[model samples]
Target chain A: MAYSNKVLDHYQHPRNVGSLDKDAADVGTGIVGAPECGDVMKLQIKVDESGRIVDAKFKTYGCGSAIASSSLATEWLKGTTVDEAMAIRNTQIVEELSLPPVKIHCSVLAEDAIKAAIADYQSKQERLREAGAPES
Target chain B: MRHVLLRLIDPFETLGLPATMDLDAATLEARYLELSRTAHPDRNAEVESDAQVAMLARAAAINDAFRTLRDPWTRAQALCERLAPGVVAATAKLSPEFLAGAMELAEAVALAERDAAEALAERIRRALAAILADIRAALTHVDARSAARLLNEARYWQKAGADLRQKLRA
Candidate 1:
């Protein structure tokens, strides 16, 4: 498949391509893969105390579309509230990247990764709250 | 009492064997030879052109079936597909811990030294062997999900192994 220059650019120079400490109180990490294609993607986010995303990072073992989708997700994730980030859909990513029908699944994987990271972060917060709760 | 369409699409059916992963290489080769002899275009030279074409197609399908059935991994994939129709068996829905481990291996593979690459490839091969053993058991029980997930993990290692080879070649 001939990728657009835009997809190629994101793939070649992916944004925020790294990891955040998943054990940290403020970091949420999401790992996902497509079994059919054997591609994996990891997306992590650092949320400030205000519950706003301060930073996002991703590392993907996938094709150009998968890499580009996660890279673009990280770029859009920064500074968005958790709710706003959750609202970000695969369609938007598809529109922004102009992904073909076949590669649309890549965008969905990216979106799922974002949600998983947020969920992980939220669960961590929940666990901490429960741990520190006063005894009944 | 299997469906006719399933029989048509089944690689084992093409090779005149039961749809089991435990088929021996000798048996497969013998069946393949037998089928090839019957379908060889040269033997059909006296037949009409259309019949010859049909034989050619059958021969091609047999070759395709054998090629896929010959590999343990490819055979596992085919078995998984048969067990779970339309299931996207190799996608990212893997467990979190496994994905993390795969990412770490992928990173290590990308920058390993020659000795390290060889060591890592060996390790991956071992891992694939273990996973394949589990997959074979899963296939026996018709546990499609477990088989699919294990096959996907093996696919990751196989790909990493291939990537390492390409890098070493470079």
Candidate 2:
């Protein structure tokens, strides 16, 4: 099936495509996949000490819809707190991108990516705390 | 649900052995070729349509069974010996830890580009292989419920591998 115009546009000229320094305590990374279509997405965020997202980036490999979903997620995540970013649902992403039913999983993958990144950040924070290091 | 009659005679049973998961691959392949010469669709083209259809179905079933049983993961799953009805529900719940690992690998793949991505992909590939091996080992001693959980975990890794492969292509 042909991708929606919005999907094609994002796929051709994706936004915020890069990685943060993973070793930085302020940066969180999330990755997700949908096995049914074999699509994978990675999302990263740089959060300030107050947990507000300072920057967002993503890379995705799949159909046009998957690329669009990750691009839209990264754009939506910037300037939001980690909590707000976590609450961004796949349904909202799908609605925003006008993704078709079959491609809905692409949006789900994007949502999962956000959660994964946040979780990773939390785990790192926990490790730092366990080590008696000052929190970033 | 549609009823499927298993009309293909059990050659292993006929040969005086129990239905087994541990068939020798080379012997099985040789036997399959021998059976195909007699029962394959191409060999039975002159037969009546209904007979030919039945023979073709039998041959196809044999091939399918052989293929499934030959693979390590699938064969381990088959050893559990539960019939088809429970297979779906039995293999659906993946562990949270496995999911987290998958998420980590996926993120790594996403950040890496071109050659760098390849290294990340290789790492994920190795991780997935290790997980699959663990699943197979677990399947050997676990009940249906636990085996299903392990199978789902394997499925997650398998999907992760597939996803990374797709990213490499992109």
Candidate 3:
């Protein structure tokens, strides 16, 4: 299928392609795959004490659209609150990427990755909080 | 045998095969060839163009069925979707650890020296073999979930192997 200029541009020059420290207390990591196509995507975010996302990165082993999708996700993620990041939708990503119907799933994968990473970050905070709770 | 199977046949049902990861290669090949010959449009009388077109579509579907069932990896991937259609979400949701391992491997592959590439290939091959064995055992014991897990793990190794090959070639 012929990709739109936006899609081709993102595919050609993806942004924030890499990963973050998944084990860090403030780092949230998300990994999602597309069942329709066997594509893997990893998205990571680093949040500060105020819950504002400070950095984001991604690594994808997938098609151009898949790579572009996650790359775009990272770009949107930086500087957003975790809640704001959670609200990012696949349709918005699709609009940003000009993804074709077939590649809508790529955007969905990116959305899923964002939510997963946020969830991971929240859970880690919960664990830290639990560990630090004063003894009864 | 061919005419009877022409009616609304799913790929697995067309091959008269179970929707499982483990398939006998010999049986798949034999059935594919048998059906190919049976479904050939030329085998139908040349009287009507309509019949020929219908036969052609059927033949194409049969070839597609064969393609879907032929590869072990794809067979499992397809079977997962088939057995649990609503469970598309269950497939390919890799873990953070798995992703980390994959990223590291990808980085290694990017800068792999000759010996390093070969070593990584060997490791991926071994991992593939182990996963296949687990899949076999899982299927034998009717452990579908474990079988899916094994197949999911195998996907990583398969990609790693492919990436390594491409890198080495470059």
Question: Against the true structure, what is every candidate's RMSD?
Answer: 4.0, 6.9, 4.7
Which run of 10 residues does model 3 chain B get worst, by summed lDDT? B1-10
Q: Which scores greater on lDDT, model 1 or model 2?
A: 1
User: Over the stretch B1-170, how does candidate 1's per-residue lDDT look in tens digits?
Assistant: 12233334778778878778898999999999999999999998999999999999999888978887888877776777777763433343778998888888888888899877878988988998899999999999998788877877876787788888989999
Error of 1 at A121 (Å): 1.8
User: Which runs in model 1 stand beyond 4 Å of their true positions?
Assistant: A132-136, B1-8, B45-57, B86-92
The local lDDT score (0 to 100) that residue A81 gets in candidate 3 is: 95
lDDT string, candidate 1, A1-136, tens digits: 9998889999889999988887888899999877656678999999987879999999998899999999999999999999999899999999999999999999999998998999999888888888995321
TM-score on alpha carbons, each prediction: 0.86, 0.59, 0.79
* Over 4 Å off, model 2: A35-38, A126-135, B1-21, B25-67, B70-170
- Please list the C-alpha lDDT of all candidates, in the order they appear: 0.85, 0.70, 0.77
Model 3, A1-136: lDDT tens digits are 8887877887889999877887888898888765345577889999998889999998887788898888888888899999899889999988887888888989998999899999999888888888995321
Model 3, position B51, has a per-residue lDDT of 78
Give the winner by TM-score: 1 or 3.
1
Give the chain B TM-score achieved by candidate 1.
Answer: 0.88
Model 2, range B47-161, lDDT digits (tens) per residue? 9999988998878766765655557566545544333335534455344455546556556655667878667767767866775666555555555456555555566566656
lDDT of 3: 0.77
Could you tell which candidate, 1 or 2, scores higher by DockQ? 1
User: Which pairs, if any, clash in model 2?
Assistant: A29-A117
Q: Please list all clashing residue pairs in model 1, or write none if there are none.
A: A33-B91, A33-B92, A34-B90, A34-B91, A34-B92, A35-B90, A35-B91, A35-B92, A36-B90, A36-B91
Q: Give the count of colliding residue pairs in each prediction.
A: 10, 1, 0
